[model samples]
Target chain A: MKGLLIKDFRLMKSQINFFIILTAVTVVLAVFSDNPSFVPGYLPFVMSVFALSTISYDEFNNSSAFLFTLPVSRTGYALEKYCLSLILGAGSWLFALAVTTVSGMIKGTAVFSETAAAALIILPFLFISVAVMLPVQLKFGGEKGRIILMIIFGAVFLIFVTALKTGEAIGNDIQAISNPLSGVNLKALFAGAFIAGAASLLISMKISCSVMNKKEF
Target chain B: MIKTENLQKRYGNFNLNCSFEVKKGCITGLVGQNGAGKTTVFKALLGLIYPDGGKAEIFGKNITDFTPEDKEKIGAALSDSGFSEYLTVKDIIPILKALYKSFDEKFFIRQGEKLGLPLNKKIKEFSTGMKAKLKILVAVSHKASLLILDEPTAGLDVVARDELLEILREYMEEDENRAILISSHISGDLESLCDDIYMIHNGKIVLHEDTDVILSDYAIIKVTEEQFKSLDKQYILRVKKEPFGYVCLTDQKAFYAENYPEAVIENGSADKVITMIIRGQEA
Candidate 1:
């Protein structure tokens, strides 16, 4: 597993310039945006997408077939991808939040607790997104998997757009719908989602293992 | 050290059902043309492909039960698909170290330099021969007890091919218990190195012979129509008709030489033996 991680990280070196550019754009957006909450999720979400691209790297030139012949097992290979995703996702999530909080403090525009809460809320979605993308990339491969990624990316975008609303009515429309169910508690709903996210992430890892084991090459 | 019992795989029209073994202290060669199922056999043994119906064992254990340590002892280099082309040799050393406890960094680096493989260049920029050399070097660096290599000498010039074969020979020499099962389209490579060879054609093991026997005992007999009519057919394995008469492949070279002193006979080679087995009709 360590070897596989090293290989993935080394592969990532080929696109370091692109990632650096992405980090710069993310920093600029977080520092300049009025609603800093949206900036935190934005960077982490984009970083998670980059994490998934490692699978495409492995699939290119049919390298996966030789990769599996190494000492690593299929289950170990699947688990390593999740580990990589978590490391990248959590690391960027913290970086984005740090910039948001520091910028907010300099301008006297933010409370740390409120900002932290909003950012924490995105962690589960980040995991769920990873949970969904890993198996799709494993099963469908890079070529067809790109289409699925776009669809899933679109869905995640909609979720973020609805959560922020941006003076538009996407979230307000949801608020209006939930008005009738006001008796439902928001805290319990969030707790339920957190558990579901963790569970689905595990199940997705298992599915990726099966996909790898059944693969011919 | 490796054995398979009727390992079977079917890909639409091609069906692979082969039984072969590579004993300790031997370099076993699997020789065949493209689409002849050599790669299928290698993949099955390596657990890269699940055999539809059959069993295989390595190091006296079933392939299904191979623990990580067991796999660590077996190094494989396939003709297709290796370390991603995006990576450089410098990047592979640390990864190999992390993966194999026995990986020798000094040896790998030394071989990389010795082979003229640039350490810092991404593999995508490597020429075909360079890539082939890298693949074999990676396999042999870990001190594996067994090696499964497919087309290891495919794209090398004669000198590079000889250098690559010497590396393989040195690897086997280090541990007398070591064994290798390799395949190549270039029969000269195998004929010069292998102790024995298996001829696989149309997804089957058509012939198995010691390299020495194939060279010394086996002979091609070219006879005119009148001569072939009276020739004994029991020793012939395969026969092809020619414009003048027939070309017969026989293992008993001495019998034909003594009985038909006037008949035309030529020494057998790996290429001629494979061509006869694959293209000639059964005698």
Candidate 2:
């Protein structure tokens, strides 16, 4: 498992420069913009997707076949991917939090409170995104996997646009439908999201392991 | 060290049903043409692909029941499978060290340098020969009891191939308990390296013989049409028509030498033996 992790980190070495540049640009934008939510929101999404890139690298030359010949099991391989995803996602989130907090302090802006609250909301979303994407990438591999991801995101975007247009057409009636949710307890919502994310991750891991075991390579 | 019992896999038109063994202290060779199921056999033994209706075992344990400790005894270099091309030799050293308990980092680097493989360059940047050499080097650098090499000399030049074979010889010499199973299309390499060889044609084992028996006892009898008509057919294993005469493959070289003094005879090498077996009419 350590060897597998080292291999993945080495694979990610080529993307280090790109990650650094992107993080810098996002931090700068967040610092200059009034809405600090951009850094927290974008960091989770980007970092979670970074895990899929490692899978792409592994599939590039059919390296997975060779990997199985090593002292690694299919179950272990699936678990390692999940662990690596958690490491990258949490690391990115913490880095974004630190940068936002420090920059807000230096600029004498009261953005830390808002950033922390936004992080709580973004954390579960990151978990769900990675939990769903990992298995898809493992199942379809590089080219087809990316194509599937694009289609999924495109459908989501279409749905979001249609919902916004429908709400605009409905005007005050849309607020009335959302009014009931305003009274929902914040702690309960967070707890529910956390539980759902955890469940999804576990189920995703199980599915990925089964998929790996069935793969012929 | 390795055994397969009626191992079977079907891929539409191609079906593999092979059974063979590689005992400790010797090298076994698998020789075949393209799409002849050599790689499939290797994958089955390594547990990279599950066999549909057979059993493969290494060191007396079924492949599916093998633990990481069991895998640590194997060093494999499979064709069409490798590390990510983006990884450098330097990057691979640490990973290998972490994976194999008996990995010799110093020896691996030394061997890589001796083979002219660049340490810092990505695998994709290397030439085909260099890549082949690197894969074999990694397989041999660890303290493994069994080495499974699929076409390890495919891209190597003659001198490099000789060098790699010499290294394999030394590896075997170092431990009596060690065994090697290598596959190649180049019959001469296997002829020189293997103690026993198995010939596969269209996913079936057509012939298996000791190297010594193949080189010394196997013979191709060249005879004219008239001569072939009178020649005894009992000794003929396979026969093919040639432009000038008939080429008959026979295992009874002594019988022909004693009885048919006028008949021309040539010692059978692996290539000739495989050709006669796969392409010739069975007796």
Query: A2-87, model 1: which lDDT tens digit per residue?
Result: 99999999988888998899888777877887887887787777777776788889988989888877898888888999999988
Cα lDDT tens digits, model 1, B1-283, are: 9999999999999999999999999999999999999999998888888899888999989888877778889889999879999999999999999989899899999999999999999999998889999999999988899999999998888988998898999899899999999999777689989999999999999999999999999999999999999999999999999998999999999999999998999999888989988889998
Interface RMSD of each: 0.8, 0.8
Candidate 2 residue-wise lDDT, B107-162, digit = tens: 99888888899999999999888888888888888889999999999978998898
For candidate 1, the share of real interface contacts preserved is 0.86
What is the DockQ (computed on Cα atoms) for candidate 2? 0.84
The local lDDT score (0 to 100) that residue A114 gets in candidate 1 is: 82
Highest TM-score against the true fold, candidate: 2
The structural similarity of chain B in model 1 to the true chain B, as TM-score, is 0.97
Docking outcome class, model 2: high
Q: Which ten residues in a row have the lowest lDDT in candidate 2 chain A?
A: A35-44
